[model samples]
Target chain A: MRRLYTILSAGAVLGLAGPAVAQNPGDTPAPAAQADPATGSSNRARSSQSPAGGLAAVSGEDAAAAPARADGGTIPPAELKSACERALRDDAEWREALGRQLTGALLASLDQRVDDAEPDQPAKKRKLEPWVEQLSTEIERKIHQRENRAIQRNNNHVIMAYAALWALVLGFVVFMWNRQRALKAEIAQLQLEVEEAAADDE
Target chain B: MKQAMYFVFAGISVLLFFYTIDLIFYGTPLDAGLYFNQKIFYYHVPQAFVLFLAVIVAGVASLLYIKRRDGRYDDVAEAAGEVAVLFGAMMLVSGSIWGKAAWGVWWQWDARLTTSLLLWMLMVGYMLVRKYGGPSADRLAAGLAIFGAVNIPLVYFSVKIWRTLHPEASVVPGLQGSMRTTFWLSVLLFQIVFVLLLIARVGQSRIQRQVREVRERALDAGLLD
Candidate 1:
């Protein structure tokens, strides 16, 4: 009996740990039990009464028939408690079957959670591996395209700016150099004319 | 010796410019925000600074010329005015290109931009007045230079006084790390360029004046008609 208590207690702890088996008032799973082919035992009997009630159901063999009162009324609290105590005293085969059923339910709940976590993507991810690979390749190609465009534009602007700057600086220097040259020529002509006038006067 | 020094300085200025350009493009890390377009700032702001320098020099020289009626002050003022115009053109052109790259527009009529445009136009007017304003051209251009100098403060502070897309004067002060170094180097390069141009211009102006004086004396002495 103590060993049966230990096993039932472990099932209750593990059932609460499961994602689907843990529930609130509105979040309770459907209150039904179907035979599990792998375990050859009935499914979890979730109680609409409360999440604790569902967890209590997981701890006993009476879970399969506990909700079925003869007059179609809800099980009395005291009777439900006595039924749980009776299930603890059930035979070893019945207890082991209950353990197997709980294990299968926990595993199923885990699988459900995993399925919920990722939907349609895993299979598609494998089947569309090449398409996704090609899509990434296209994305990388587009990024490089944009980068090259920016580089070309930058080169044009920087080159133009530098060229314009040099052009202005050089243009001014040339202008000044030309003016100096013209002034020198004019001064030479003036000197020649002055020499001619001086010669004539002499 | 001074002529040789000037040539040496010019050579160094050219070499420094190439070195700074390499540092600006290759050595300096790109601005995280502006990226490629921010490179224009290295030259643009420096040219603007030189433009302001030229304007101030022109204004002060013109003022001195006005007070003393000295031809030397006028010559300096004339050289400064030309340099101001040249640098102003540079500032405007580079600024426009940067604006197009950064702001998606080549021009805007905001306070700083408008005032800068006006300042350039005023300098242009000064140049025009000098070329064609006849005997009184000097006095008129001198007044224009004084006006332009006064407008400099307005241009510098326009971003502060009014909300504008153009960056404030605090940009230089806000720079950090290698950006600050590269920026100042560009400024030095431009200043050297400005001084060389100004010296060349002043020398030419003095010679022109000497030639005119000689021609007048020759005519008066009946050496030549």
Candidate 2:
């Protein structure tokens, strides 16, 4: 039951904090520890007590980005850029941590199974590394698919925006041009009428 | 000479448009969270600036028309009001697209967006009154223009006054590096475009007024039935 709870907790952590952790390469080791529920509380305390340098990386970036976020809520562009770069670079680190935590739970379950197995049953070789590796690969693939979908959505939004802007501007210009043409024709027609009226008066 | 000057100005505006487009796409760095989507800011914010400028111009000209009772002032007011409607529509449309990209929602009834929508609607009302309000159309639109001009400050300060999805005015002042340069260049470009459009629209308005006067005289003289 404890193992089941641990696996579920790890999944919850990964789902919530995975991308955040991947983007903070300079973060102290507190995150890796926090990723595991067993040591989360104690590790958080240790990190809080650690010297300022341990948190300097994140703090320094935040300081640089402070002006852009003075309004308090919006993420600044520079910080976002740096975060994206770090996420791209340290993506493997996050996947490794996730794999370790997930497989850690699986291994614990396997250990219980071994303990309950008869002494002779344990003599049969059980290689679990390949299965663990395959599971990790599947998770990574799913994450990549989700990221791609998000990126595609962003691209679509941007293209539609630019298209809408240009289309509207062009439409307005055409409207003005057509109005000018119609007015010019009316003016020409009015001038002819005035000329004919003057001839009739003479 | 005036026609030559207008052509020169148009040429320069075209050149600036190309130059700024290159700078926006290539010279400026990608912003963090929105990535390529943030590029919309280069166009969106500048159009907003032009929108405000047009509305203000319309209000001031309308005030002059009311005080002086001059048809030229009315012409200027009408031209500026038309430009305001054009740019206001652009601002709202682009802004909605940006909201969709950044906030995952196309429209939010937040303070800034709501106020901007109101301002745009007022400008549309100005145009509609001008088209169908008979001889008093100019006066009615001028009134709407003054009201819209008053609304400008509300839209400009909406983010500060209330919690909103739109960025604060400080965001422009806070920009740094290439982002700052690109942003100002975009503002300049949009302003030039606004001036050109205003001049063209004003010229058209003047001609329309002349045509009306000429037609009225001919009718008084029994030139046509």
Candidate 3:
């Protein structure tokens, strides 16, 4: 009984420890430099205002700059490069934030998309609708992945519980089987002594 | 003294049965809904308590049997084992039913449920070994009973040691006073039922032994001739 109590207490302590070990690896908080505040607000406004035209302008600039950077020659002046870098960084931040806002807007637009692919007032609506759809899909995929991980953790817990139960039961059965055999042998020996005493009396 | 104890047990069981009914009807219902599985709690938890009490009683009786070699002590141990098996079986069945209702499945390999099922199997196995294995079976059965009884605590603690969805110990460090009062009252009532069942079963065993002795004597005297 004391042995049982010890094993049970040990098992409970382990169970309590498991969740602490398995919790999403502490999330790391995303680098502070990459999380600019102005980018978030601009992204929201751009996605609500001119989405497609904004994406097209950014993509065009990116395409033109890619070849210039690839040719790594004398390059632009330090002042010009720094100014361009700042502008591009700010633009990229805004685009990223806009992508997040569009992701939410796209989910709301899904029923509208199904009802009519072309809007009556097309100029008034956000033009980069496809980019919004793409962003939303990515976010949904990430959410699904997170849910799957939670489910897997739940399953692992169940499997561990069953494995422990079976181990305990099997261990118990083996112990009892051996004990029963030993007791039978002792009982037989005692019976033999009783028979010998009876014979001596005779 | 025995008669007085019997009356006490009878009174407690009656009181508990009514109290359980009152709770079912008037208590703050759990958000889980009022299903047949919920109703089973009145009987299933009581049965589980009885099973635990029976195992403890058997352990104590076995200790007495070992010291005294008195047939009466063996009788008590055997009776307790039988009663434990009966209540354990009920607990297993009702628990499975409750699992089906709560989990949308007939059975789960959860720690608490599996440990309980294993205990039931052990108790049933103990009784079978005693009944079919002849005169020396008592000694073998007694050893198995002690071992199985001892494993109860281990089975209970398995959930705590392993990560399991089965809820943690309800009687842990921080419980509200009202919850504790209800829990203790339930335990007390169940303990009374355990004593009542133990006495009834042991009395039956004693009567059966006397009848067997009478039959043996008649056979020796050639009463049929």
Identify the leading candidate in terms of lDDT.
1
> Could you estimate the TM-score for every candidate?
0.67, 0.65, 0.47
Candidate order (DockQ)? 1, 2, 3
**Of models 1 and 3, which has the larger TM-score?**
1
Worst 10 residues of 2 chain A by lDDT: A49-58
Q: Note the Cα lDDT for every prediction shown.
A: 0.78, 0.76, 0.61
Looking at model 1, residue A89 earns an lDDT score of: 58
Encode model 1's per-residue lDDT on A53-137: one tens digit a residue.
4344465565545576778988887997777657745665776766565645454444444477867545543333222434555
Tens digit of per-residue lDDT, candidate 2, span A46-124: 4433323323333458545444556778776788877855764578766455446444544554555667887665333
What is the TM-score of each candidate's chain B when compared with the real chain B? Answer: 0.94, 0.93, 0.79
Best model number under DockQ: 1
List DockQ, one per candidate, in order.
0.40, 0.38, 0.02
Pairs of residues at least 3 apart in sequence or in different chains that clash in candidate 2 = A80-B32, A81-B32
The C-alpha stretches of model 3 lying farther than 4 A from their native spots are A1-202, B1-5, B32-43, B154-163, B171-181, B214-225
Better of 2 and 3 by DockQ: 2
Candidate numbers, best TM-score first, in rank order: 1, 2, 3
